[model samples]
Target: MSQSIIAKRYADALFQLGKERSKLDQFETELLTLREVYRDNNKIVSFLKHPRVSVDQKKKVMTDSFQSFSEEIVNTLKLLVERHREDIIADMIQHYIGMMNDAKGIADADVYSVRELSEAEKQRLSETFAPKVGKQSLNLTNIVDSSILGGIRLRVGNRIFDGSVSGKLRRIERELVSTNKR
Candidate 1:
C-alpha cells in the first residue's frame, strides 16, 4: 500500500489509543525513540523487511530487544509487525504525531537553507517564527538545500516565506517583467 494510506491508519489508531490512555505525551517521546531505533539499526530494519522471516519471529525479537518500554508501545508494535506493516512504521508514527500536533493547534515549519545552521541560529529562527506566524511555538524541520545559493526559506502549512537568494532573484525577474508589461 501507499505511504499515505498506511500513515493514515497507523496515525489514527495511535492517536486514539494515546488519547484514551492519557499517555499521549509519553507515546510521542517513545515513538521518536522507536523511529530512531529503526533508523540506527539497519540490520534490524532489513530483518523486519525480509520476506522470509515470519511475523512471529519479528514480534519475539521486538519483545526481547526493547524490553524497557511501556506495555502499550510494546503491544502496539507487536500488532504492526504481525500485520506486516513494519516497513512504514517510522512514517506512521510521524504521521500520528503530526495529527496530534494539529489537534493541539501546533504549526509545522519546514526551513530550507543553503548551509546547515548552528544551534544558536535555530533557536533564533524559532523566536522569529513566533511573531511572524502569530503562534506561540513551532515544530520546525531543518532542510539543507545548497542549490538555494544563500539565505533561508520557510514553509508552514500553506504559507511560504522565501528568502533564499535564488528565490529572490526569480521574484525580482517576475516583478521586472510585470513592470515592463505595465
Candidate 2:
C-alpha cells in the first residue's frame, strides 16, 4: 500500500481509539507536539531510521523522549519504529489531527495581513468565515505579510479569499489587460 494510505489507516485506528477513550483532544495535542518535535529535530528521525540502530534502541529512545505522553501515542511510536515506518510518522500525525479537527467541526486557517491581528479581530474573522466553509469555527494562524498591503487574505484548505488591497489591484489589472487586448 502507499505511504499515505498506510498513514491514514493508522490515523483512523488511532482516532477510533481516541474516541473510545474520550481522549481525542488530548491525543490531538500530543500528536501536535510529536509533529513539532519531528519537524524541529531531523536527527531524531535519522537516528530512528539508521540501519545500525536496533529496533529496541529506537523504541527506548521514543519512549524516553515522550515518557509523559499518553500510552497510546508512545505505543504507536514504538510500533512505527518496529515496523520500519518512521518516515510516515509525521503524515500519520497530520492525518490524525485532521480527523480530530473534522470531528470537532474546526478548520485550520491562515490569515495574512500587514500586521498581527488582535484576538477580537481573529475571533470576528473566524465567526464570519467559518460558516462559509461549513465549519463551526476556525483555528486562525495570523501571518504578518506586508505584501498584502492592507485588508486581510484568508486561506482555508484549497480556497483563498483575497480581500487584500494587493489582491484587488491585481484583479483590476487583469481586467484592464484583458479589456485592452479585446
For 28-96, candidate 2 gives per-residue lDDT tens digits of 999999999999998998899899999999999999999999999999999999999999999999899
RMSD of each: 2.7, 1.7
Candidate 1 Cα outliers beyond 4 Å, as residue runs: 1-3, 114-120, 131-134, 142-151
Candidate 2, poorest ten consecutive residues by summed lDDT: 95-104
For candidate 1, write residues 1-182 as lDDT tens digits.
Answer: 68779868877887888899998888888888988988888999899889999989999999998788778888888888998878788888779788777776677888999877887887788778856877666777889999889999999888888989999999999999999999
Residue 50, candidate 2: alpha-carbon lDDT: 97
Candidate that would win on lDDT: 2
Residue pairs in steric clash, candidate 2? none
True-structure RMSD for candidate 2: 1.7
- Local distance difference test, per candidate? 0.84, 0.95
